[model samples]
Target: MNAFSLRRVGLALLAPAIAVVVSVIVTTIVIAAVGSSPGDFWSAMFSNPLPRIRVNVVNQTAMIYTSAVAAAIGFRMGLFNIGLEGQYLMASFAAASFAGAAYVGGFLNVGLSLLIAIAVGAAWAGIAGILRTTRGVSEVISTIMLNAIALTLVGYLVDRYGVHEGNTVRTTKIAAGDMVKGFTPYQARDGQVWALAIIAVLVGVGFWVLLNKTRFGFDLRASGQSESAALASGVNPKRMILVSMMLSGGVAGLIWMPALFGSAGSYGTSFQFGLGFLGIAVALLGRNSPIGMLFGAVLFAYLSAQSNTLTFSTDISPSIVQITQGVAVLAVVISYEVVRRWRARLEQRVVSRELAGAMGATA
Candidate 1:
């Protein structure tokens, strides 16, 4: 790339880099204040951030990325999508229930389950969208209520109709034909790498393409940036709201696949939750870019994975990770906005200078 392009890329990276540095410094200070050596904390924190040192880093990172992308979708449309927690949970239950009821083996099973999940998520989010567009309800309030409703609904379904194999309260295990194929990342270890990681990568790619390469993306972004401008430009604001929410919800549905198809092979009372709220934080850290989200998700995942090891290795509270994350998100938000303003000023200066030089030449 040319110098201008390189400079722009550097400018884009500056905020995230600063956020990471600040978070590390803050975390180290917190650890030291708690009577631990910063050196020891760093050593332990970095000791196993990778797959060789740890087994599920990549898989978990992918799941975080999926969640981030889900939130990012609504973010790009200027929507908070706070109900993603509900959307994913409800979708997971629906997918699992349907998958259990259907005996179709192989790719079809996985496909159908995923399809059901996507549909349920979209439909759930659509409720908020419809309310927002038609009745002028604030999405924040509606989604929060929807989340409560979703949890209550899922709890009821699991209690009343969940499959019980002996004592476990889980949906029937998806047949091998329906389950994602697992592979060992390292030859020596027996742990199976989550096959859903592939799907996560695809989700990121698709998100990028949808937002950056399509006309619909333009309209979506325009609406996010200024709904009035988009409406003036022949974009239907109401339709965009509905479509974007559904799209966001559809992607949110995939947040549990890593655990479902790869780890659990069934939905249960014990399945993972809360990824939707985590996704909001991840999206903020990433600034809603696919590439940024990948890095942000991995970093967050590394911290999350470290929480377990940190507990065993030191006297430090594992909640330190949460503090670090909150600090990082706050730093990124504040620093990035400042950087963006600075960059905008710099670009304006360059444009004015070029125009002045042209006028001088003409004179």
Candidate 2:
């Protein structure tokens, strides 16, 4: 990479670095005030969150990474598609219902089920997109309302047709043979490794390539950076909005797959929630870079996994993690502005140096 690219990368890392340092300092003070040995707590976490990073952490990171990428798609386009919660849940419900109701068998069944999920998620988000493009409604409002509708629908259907054994409620399990194969090598104490981990990695790579290497991605980003400039460049803002929203939701459909295919084999009342919103935080922390999001998701998963150990061993509250997360995000937001100005100065210096060199050569 050139100096500008290297500097840009540094700018990207600066905010998260500052946020981590600030969060640690604040969290330590809070722990000390709470009558806990802040030094001991920090030592325990930094020494080892686990004997080693567990498979569960890896799986959770992958899931979160997918969620972050879904949100990043919208971020890149300057559209906040807050309806990821609705899109993924509806997709999971549709996937579970279709997979259980069908008699199809094997990997083919799994593939089809996943396709159903992507389509359902995209279609749900499409509603919001259509409204935004045609009626100029704010996506934030439409998506929030859609989340309520999606949840209500899921609740009703699960109650009506979901398998209810005793008091527990879950979707009917697919055939045992149909479960996606797990990576036994990476299995933690839980012995459940999400086979879809490969899929998550692919998604990250694809996301990076799409945004950096494709024309549509360029148009989407252009519209995001400046709608007026994009319009002057002959880009259609309406189409960008619609396409980016659908793309965001389509990727979001896969967020639940790791949990569903890797563990549940079906959707249930007990399925994981709030990841969609968590993804927004991840996207912000990572500044929408796929690699950056990977590290951000892993850091989040690590902190969360470590919190359980902290709760058991220290007087400090586990809810401290929430405070840390909030503070870290706030720190990053503030630090980003500082880094932005720093980068602009660096770029100006480089331009001035190059201009001086050209003048000297001519003289």
Candidate 3:
């Protein structure tokens, strides 16, 4: 990379670095306040690379990375798509219901279910887009409202259609052979690294290519950076908003697949929640880079996995991980503004010097 590229990369990483340092300091204070030896907590956090733990991290990374991308797409387009939680929930429900209802073999079941999820997610997101474009409704408001609606709607749908087995209501049971299977060399007592991990890798690669290498991506980004400038450059701002929002929701749809296909095999009240909101933090931590997003996801997942061991083995509260996550996200947001202003100031100085030099030469 050139000097400029290197500097940009440095700036990109700076926010996450600040988050890590600040979180550690805060966590140390918390541990000390709790009368626990910080070293013991820290030791357990890094020492375990057990096969099962690794598998859990991989699965968590897959879901979080996909969610990060879903949020990042909207962020790149300057759209706050807070509706990812709703979109993914509806998508997962549809995917589960479809897969359970139909047994079209292996890959066909997976493929059709995926398409259904993408479509449902995109459609749900498009409602906010439509409102934004036609009625001037703020996406933040619309998405939040939609999330509430989705939760309520899902509860009704579940009660009306879901199969009740004892206390838990889940979708129809998928065939054991039909569901995607994960493998492990270490032979975990239960659960393997999700085979759907490949899908997360694919999403990251495709995300890079679409945003960096395609004209549509360019238009969407330009629109985000400045709508007036994008219009002048012949990119329609409204179209970009609608399309980007839907695209974001489409990717968000994939967040549940790793767990659904590789583990849960059905959607129910027990399904994961809050991943959508978490995606926003992960996206900010990622700085819109696929590798950065993956790193952030893995870091968060590792922290969770490590925290699990702490509850069973020590007096330390597992809730410390939650505090670390909150602090890291807050620190990242603060550092991002600092970096932005720093870059702007540097640009202004360079411009002023260039103008002064030109005037001197003319004189």
Candidate 4:
């Protein structure tokens, strides 16, 4: 890679690391304030029936990574997808509904249902994309509004067509064969691994290729960087914008696969919350890079998993986890800006030195 590319990668890595360190520091302070020993908290966080802890880690990792990927896809195209939670809910409900309607093989049926969920999510997101492209609406506003619409629409669907006989809000449980498994290679109470977790990593790799190696990816980036320039250069900026939003929504749908297919077995009103906003934070921490996003997701997962253990072993409230997450995101944002400025100054210096050398040779 060129120096510029390497620098970008470095910044991406640095942002998440800075966030993690800041979160640790903030968490330590909170522990002290709560009259808990930070050392004990740390011990509880790390020492465990390693397999069980790993399972929780894998679950959170999968969820966060899927959400992060959804946000990153939109961020790359200069669109903010704030409807991931609703999209996830809708897709999960669709998947569960399909699974409940028919019994099939373990992997085959689940795979097909997931495919349908992705398509549904894409279509849902495409609505906002179309609005922005044809009606000149802001995607930020459109997506936010669409989130509410999706929640209401999916809630009604679950109640009317998908819910179990006795349940007031939740859909029916997906069959055993339809749940995602083998996500972490660790044994759990359910004996199921989050197959979606493995899928999330593959999706991350696919995203890397999509954003950096493909012509479509180039067009998306160009439009994000400069819409008018991309339009002048023969790119269909409107189409790209619409397509990017759909892709973002599709990724969001993946987040729900684990919840719907792996454990929850159903969709409910309470099932759709916080994930969309968390996705925005993950995207910022990842700086729109797929690999970086994976790391950020893993870190967030670790923190989240640790929080529960910490609560059990100490006087610290579970709310401390939220505080840490918020501080981490804020720290990462500020650090990213600072690092970007520094890199820009370094590039300027390099260019200035080259120009001086050229002038001296001319003289």
lDDT of 2: 0.85
Model 1: weakest 10-residue lDDT segment is 48-57
Candidate 4 lDDT: 0.78
Residue 327, model 2: Cα distance from true site in angstroms: 1.9
TM-scores of the candidates are: 0.91, 0.90, 0.91, 0.86
- By summed lDDT, the worst window of 10 consecutive residues in model 4 runs over 181-190
> What tens digits encode model 4's per-residue C-alpha lDDT throughout 94-142?
8777776766767788888889889888888988899999999998888
Ranking of models by lDDT: 3, 1, 2, 4
**Whole-model Cα lDDT of every candidate shown, in order:** 0.85, 0.85, 0.88, 0.78
When sorted by TM-score, best at the front, the candidate numbers are 3, 1, 2, 4
Give residue 285's error in model 4 in angstroms. Answer: 0.9
Which ranges in model 3 have alpha carbons more than 4 Å from their true place?
1-14, 343-363
What is candidate 3's lDDT per residue for 44-72, written digit by digit as tens? 88885677888888888889999999999
lDDT of 1 by residue, 117-200 (tens): 999999999999999999999999999999999999888878788776667677777776677767877764546778877878
Task: Report each candidate's C-alpha RMSD, comma-separated, in the order given.
Answer: 2.5, 2.8, 2.6, 3.4
TM-score of 1: 0.91
